[model samples]
Target: MALCSKIIEHDDTGRYLTINQIYTEPFPSAAASGKLRVEDNNGIVWILSYRVKSGGTRVFSGDWPRFVQNYKVKAGNTIVIGMNGTGSTDHKIEVM
Candidate 1:
């Protein structure tokens, strides 16, 4: 299932990318306090730290910046994040 399909912004190219709250439910709760594994289209696995802010906003940090840079992600690019199955923390990303 698709977790997020966001148009990248300049700010998003920084240290982290915030997952929209609406899609937070499918994310592994363990990731709420630890790391989530995401495989990019190139088969590279990115270990990203996940956290929930005071108001339930979800964010991914750690290798996210590297992933963004490696993928040449930039403002105006669109990225789709998805999971292979329900309740799966192993996710994938597609850049367009």
Candidate 2:
């Protein structure tokens, strides 16, 4: 029982996103697939992969420093991913 069909992404301005494009039914395995969408300062959108269970972004990347430095993601800008989860997990993504 985990967050399924989830997505997470950040923008050039450091705005993060997490959306559920799949579901309406609990397939579990079906929700395992990643489905993230991000919008940058330029208004361009990007799709991010789902965070793998407990392993986290280790399979992805750890860019807290880089993310903090590059984007103003806090407060209204604080990017949130995996709403189904604790929402405390930080998935690293280097926005280029």
User: Which candidate gets the maximum lDDT versus the true structure?
Assistant: 1
Task: Show where candidate 1 strays beyond 4 Å.
Answer: 30-33, 85-89
Using TM-score, give the best candidate's number: 1
Q: How many residue pairs clash per model? A: 0, 2
- Across residues 1-96, which tens digit of lDDT does each residue of candidate 2 receive? 232322233432243333334334332332365444433344433444334444232122233334445564433343433323223222222232
lDDT accuracy of residue 6 in candidate 2 = 27
Clashing pairs in 2: 5-31, 7-36
Error of 2 at 30 (Å): 9.2
Worst 10 residues of 1 by lDDT: 84-93
TM-score of each: 0.81, 0.27
Pairs clashing within candidate 1: none
Q: What is the C-alpha local distance difference test score of candidate 2?
A: 0.35
